[model samples]
Target: MRLSQAFQPTLKEIPAEAQIASHRLMLRAGLVRQTASGIYTWLPAGLRVLRRIATIVREEQDAVGGQEVLMPTLQSADLWKRSGRYDAYGPEMLRIQDRQKRELLYGPTNEEMVTDLFGSTVKSYRELPKTLYHIQWKFRDEIRPRFGVMRGREFYMKDGYSFDASYEEAGYSYFRMMLSYLRIFHRLGVKAVPMAADTGPIGGDLSHEFLVLAPTGESEVFYHHDWDLMDWGTSPLDPQKSEDLDALKEIVSKTYSATDEKHDEASWQNVPEDKRRSGRGIEVGHIFYFGTKYTEAMGVSVSGADGTAFHPHMGSYGIGVSRLVGAIIEASHDDHGIIWPDNVAPYRAAILNLRPGDESCDALCERFYQCDPEGLLYDDRSERAGVKFNDADLMGHPWQIIIGPRGAKNGMVELKRRATGERLELSVDEALAKVGLN
Candidate 1:
């Protein structure tokens, strides 16, 4: 798209409220704007990046056999009441009274609601073992919400719930979810480590939170030094057999990893000091195995092979969709703006037309822009060459193909890699081939 008419409001001065680099860059880059305390309005450029992250989350979930479902943000308060959490959820749960004075809430998470859905529809062991997910908005009234979208009160989230007729079956699904989370973050260009964690608000005996390491992270965590060396590749994790899921679970569970809240001093000391690594971590995803907590509370029962009614084991997994955008920025940005992974960048490249109206420069930029599958943010705005160069770097596209009258006259365009500041001048034809259109 042409920057001449685009709504990219680049800022010279950083907003004081933005304490981190990603938050500051997000504002200057025209990705998002604060709508309320912790709520935000994602501008076109920001939303494009957000959606790309969501796409990767969806694809990985699908690969792990999760069927997508869109759950309502507003859930019946009665469901939470059944789980005995409506009154205990504290002020974070945005409680409301509907027109009839009935209690309702903007769901913080959907385990109870999902359980209600499961028990109402699923009735037997034959339909056992199903994983369903939804991508929607969730609200939690953080008393002191800060850090831009990183700890926002209102955010987009991708949450999934799994159901199985037996506890053993549910455990396997949990493992698959862990493996899926590992792959998702790796593809997004970061190393995300899974650590044993307290269930927190999402209760269960078994839980894990996937964290991407960043010095700016909130949670203090400890893990093995070679934690990043574990391989969780696509080795055909078919969940048809119980052992398939169990084996994966064992491998992941055996690793020494835990968040501060879940840390055990005695257990950790067992590992040699050289092997222990402590660092701050940002939670990107979390999963839980809460056996029959919601199922029994909501009377969600399925008939066993013996025809006896039994509550199914259930679990919920979540990726803080909006928080991840910030987490990724926290993990990946440099002196400029966001250096987005090719998969989630709003535009793959920025076309800098230094000699805007010059025939040769104009012709080359227009051609390059046309070749862009929404891949180019063509900077045809009236600006100095230096201004355009700075803006292109600030916007952070991987490739910046600069066309000037001089370069055009010489039948060449200077191509620069945003990440490395490496420049290559290529012929018009060569530039086209190098741009590698969307």
Candidate 2:
């Protein structure tokens, strides 16, 4: 993506409405623009990052045996009514009526709808366990939506539903999702701690919320220091094994982590002072083992071995696909701008042609840019070197290939790491190797 032709309208002055770092930076970096009170239009650069995050989410969900499915944003009101939540869901649900005067709603969540779908389809115990997921936009009428996408009314989300024949089977599915969430966050280059959480309207005894630590987080959190040292991605626990799932559950059970709403005073006292860690955190993912809450309410059941109808235990897992964009920025950004993790960055590196028209500089940058045109953002704009440098840092590419005339002429270029502010002078070939350009 070349800067000259890119539709990234970066702002020099901060928008007055943006109160958080992610919100402010998102607007200034030209990632998104507010179209309504709580709605946003994602720009080219932002969409690339969003798609990348969705890809990671989709891959992780697939790893856990989740089948991809697309559920509509709008749902019939009858589903919620049958589940006894149409009235209980409150004003957050945007209830509406079509020209035929039939009731409908922009679904805040898909528990009732998904339950109905499951009930209408698979009816035998042979198909007892199934997980279906989709990445889609959701709308909840937040009375006071703020903090950019963090608390937006309409945002992209990855929601999955799991159905099992029994409570024991459901427990396995729950723990499997817990392990998957941890791995997903780890791959995205963020440490999100799973803490005990209230099920609220979801109505489940077992629930966990994944919160990413950040100074500007909405909730205060407390956790054991072990969370920081543990590497979930490298863990040997396999979701396919029941014993491994149980072990993963045991690990979570022993860990002391909670939001302020659920913090136990006695439990806090039990932990050694040195092992206690407290900070603000942003909620990014949540998992709920609701058992038969939805199945029972919506009359979803599968035939047992003896041909008896029984409600399937169910669980719902959610990751704020759009909110993660902001949560990651909140957790990883420096004073300058967003520091996108390499896996989720829109472009892996930025090729800043310090002297675009210069014969040597243009030739060197073009060579590097051509090596991986799709993964590199070529700054071919006729702008000053200072502008190029600032924008490169603001965009937060993992690497910046700086090609000044002097260095280009010598067959050398300066390579800068965005996260660490480290610079190295390397030969053109070495620079390509360093950034994995080829």
Give the Cα lDDT of each candidate: 0.86, 0.92
Give me the candidate number with maximum TM-score. 2
lDDT of 1 by residue, 1-438 (tens): 899989888898899999988789989888899999999999988898889899999999998799998989998999998999999899999988989999899999998888878777888899978899999999999999888889999999999999987776787788878778877887777778889899887788998888989998889999987677765555666645667777767766666899999998988898789888889999989989999888887777889999898988988899998988888888877887778777778898899999788998998788788886476799998899999988888878878989999988888999998777899989988877887863
Give the TM-score comparing model 2 with the true structure, all chains together.
Answer: 0.99
lDDT for residue 24 in candidate 1, whole number 0-100:
94
Check candidate 1 and list the clashing pairs: none
RMSDs, each prediction?
1.9, 0.8
The local lDDT score (0 to 100) that residue 84 gets in candidate 2 is: 95
For candidate 2, write residues 38-144 as lDDT tens digits. Answer: 99999999999999999999999999899999999999999888999999999999999999999999988899888888899999999969999999999999999
